[model samples]
Target: MKTIYALLGASLLSACSVPLIQPNATQAVASHYGTSAPQGGAALDVNWWSRMGDAQLTQLLALARTNSPDLRSAAASVMAARAQSGQTGANLYPSLTGSASATISDSPTTPRSDSNTALVDSKWELDIFGKVQNAAKADTARAGAEELAYAGSYVSLAAEVADGYVGYRACRLAQAEYQNALASQQDTVTATGSLVDAGLSASADLSLARANVANAEISVTNQRADCKVAAQSLARIVGVSQSEIDAVISKGGGLPKTKPFQVASVPADMLRQRPDVLEAEKRFAAALLDMKVAEAQLFPSLTLNGSITASDPRSWSFGPALSLPILDGGASRAGVRLANANALTAAESYRAATLTAVSEVEGALTRLAAARSNLASAQSLVANYQAYFDTVDRDWKVGAASLLDREEARRQLQSARITRISQSEAVLVQWIALYKAIGGGWVAPKVVISKDLAPKKIEG
Candidate 1:
């Protein structure tokens, strides 16, 4: 027994002694907006959708939050992880259970008699080597990972809803442009036909005008179809009936406008705020803990177990129990190696995730910059084209120019307007990308959950 205890103690100490690997030497990417990341801005509110200042979008987001299956699954996962953590943590303390028994016996020549017994039993494992402590830590880390995962899912879902809404709005705007273009083209076709009848234009010119009108009609058809598809997608996201979506569509509104958002300057600390990155880090930490646990198993285990029982002929008694491993080939050592390898794999995965996050942020920044530039150019072109169209319309009204000149000016104006609207939508989509790249609003809610909620036993 003494030898067993000594061996167990030695094993526990060795297992607990394994050092935690430090985070790799890779430098964190800096924020691109400034020389340094902001000390603090607005606290990342959970209702980030409302910040966009669109009541309709807010309503849609609310509906999505309630009905999104992904969010539901993530929530369920959090609950499961919490329950698992609680169960593992409970092992660190004494467990008390109530037991009751009734027995009847009959002697060969005597009447039968019954005995009833009821008692509470308590057992505690003395975690002398920190085995249970390590297990508890692993479970806690896992639970934290699950929580981050939930936040990630929520952010992702929100972003998706935003993107889908923006897409629908863009489609609507495009459809409107096509419809307006078709009307203008139809007028041009009519004017060309009148000119041809009056011997002012050739038949070929009329044919060209008719072709333009046909092309415009085709574009309108395609745009309408696209709008319908977008509406269907939005309906699926909000989990509403198609008719309900159509009703929402009946309320005319322009596509969401983009607002200037302050970008972070430094790139290095940006990853720290991303929930997915944080989750990966936590998982890596847990994996390291698991590796330590496996290493601990290489050595013998010392268990201090005691039980007290009262029998018909004996009273309650208690004593310590111990276990030792003499030999099991190289199974224990091999387990340690396996665990170490897993830890290494987890570390690599964490590094990969971090790198990927940086790349995504950088890409989003690039896209946003491009979109901004395009929008500015498009806005300028629209202004210029609008002036040109007004001038040409005035000239043609007084017979200063041919009707074809006015028609061309109108076409140019419509094209410029459509381009501007498309660019504006692009900017909005880019902003969404930026929001997602910056990890959406994951930090605040997670902090709140961790700080306010006490770890409780989760019923599976």
Candidate 2:
């Protein structure tokens, strides 16, 4: 008994010797992006998609949130993590269970008799070694990590829906432009045909008009196909049927308008807003706690475990139980090494995440700036070409310009319009990229623990 008590005391001491995790290489990398950096924005609302000022986009995002399988999977993960944390925490206190039983016996010389018994059994491995505490801490950290992961999923989904909506609108705008060009080409073909019938136009002129009409028809066909594909993709993202998508398409809307918002901030703010970065950090913390748990195993553990059993002829008594690791073939040492290595790896991952996040933000900023410049240039070209085309049209109506000259001016106007639309689409795509780089508005996880297992004082 004395030996057992001594062993238990030694084990308890060893278990309590959980080591502290020093900052590792990964932590150094994370520091480059800065931790808990102050961002110049309000707490991101759940309705972040509404900020884009597109009613259709808002509706699609809502549909995704309601029906997306990925979001549902993420929510399930959060629930699982919460349950696991609670289970681990339960080990921190005594476990009490009750049992009742009845037995019947028959003897050769005596009548049969029945005996009934009921008892409440309680057992607890006192956490003097901090093993249970470390386990609980690790579980808690993991739960937090899972929660961040869920939030990251939601943010990703929102970004995807928004981008798909924008792409769909752009495709529609392209189709509209192509349709107008096709109509202009048809008109040109008709005019050329009338001139040929009147013997005022050459066969070569009719041939050129026929070629323009065919080219316009091809362009329209391609645009329509692209628009159809875009609409289908958008429908898939929002978890709707193709028929529903077609219905939405039947109700026409103009191209998405751009807001004049300036991104005049450093990359660090964007890194801080990213949900992936937060998830990585939480995972890092969990790894650190696991390492601490592994190190704590190298020490002895003390447990006050006892059981009471009563027989038919007597009562029962109990005493403390202790355990110590005398020899385990370096298992504890190996555990410590493995845990430390994992911690190092986790740290590296954190650093990599931070670096990647910063890079994305910087790249998006550069692209957005370039896109804005290109858009301005394209707008100016479109305006100039529009004025020139209008002057040529007036001159042609007054018999001061040749039909060929009018056709050339119309071609230039169409080219300018197409270029402007392309630039506008590029600008919108860049803006979406910038928003994604800025982390799509994630908040920290909220933790709650039950108070049902409050420890009771045991009087001597």
CA lDDT, candidate 1, residue 42: 55
RMSD of 1: 5.1
Show model 1 residue runs off by greater than 4 Å: 1-48, 103-121, 203-207, 306-314, 384-413, 447-460
Q: Local distance difference test, per candidate?
A: 0.73, 0.71
lDDT of 1 by residue, 1-460 (tens): 6876677676555545444444342435544642222233354445456766777787777776666677666777787788899999999888877677999999989899999886656677777656688888998998999888877877787788888888888888878888988887788788778878988767876777788889899989998998898888888877777887677666758876454455456555667768888888888888878876766565555555444454532555466655554456757666667767777777777788788777877777778778878999999999999999999978864557776787788888888988998888888887788778778855535422222232122222
- For each candidate, what TM-score against the reference? 0.82, 0.82
Q: Write the per-residue lDDT of candidate 2 for residues 162-217, one digit (tens) a residue.
A: 77777777777778888998898788788778877888767777788788889889
- The candidate maximizing lDDT is 1
Residue 252 alpha-carbon offset, candidate 1, angstroms: 4.5
